[model samples]
Target: MEQANIQMTEPGVSRADLAKLLAQALGNEKASDVVQKAASKLGIRRDPLDKGQALSVLEQIAQTPGLVGITARFAKSRLHLR
Candidate 1:
């Protein structure tokens, strides 16, 4: 699959927007948990993440090696990665 190369510094989707999409994909409760885990793994130091941090976390998720990563990469493509 061809994934968009989103730069860490580039502005992407908002945290709330990403959470909403994730909620739709993985259920309401799992959304926050996924973001938290991704953020924690990426060393993001805040809640209500800034766009860059959110993108960083999303990128981390996309790189994860498993079915989750495949799902995440597919979802990442749906986001505005500009």
Candidate 2:
């Protein structure tokens, strides 16, 4: 199974939601690339909200250039917005 698929099996958050968050935060095309890069740097698969790694991955993404626009508040509000 894909890493994202495995991560999505639990609950709470879904891979699609995580992807949407990244896409919105970083902008679609860029977000896709940024997520892949962040995943590699974190030594984790491209599963942003994977178990215990979610927050850490998000933190790393937030530190990336141009991603400061993505705030914790925005992430929290995402579910409600959907």
* Candidate with best TM-score: 1
Stretches of model 2 off by over 4 angstroms after superposition: 1-16, 46-49, 67-73, 76-82
lDDT digits (tens) for residues 12-78 of candidate 2 = 4444455567676556666556555655688876543554455555566667555443653356455
Write one digit per residue (lDDT tens) for candidate 1, span 1-82. 9999987664445556666766766676676678778877877766666666666777787786775566566667666444
Clashing residue pairs, backbone N/CA/C < 3 A, model 1: none
Stretches off by above 4 angstroms in model 1 are 1-15, 65-67
By summed lDDT, the worst window of 10 consecutive residues in model 2 runs over: 64-73
Quote model 1's TM-score. 0.61
lDDT of all predictions = 0.68, 0.55
My TM-score estimates for the predictions, one after another, are 0.61, 0.54
Error of 2 at 24 (Å): 2.6
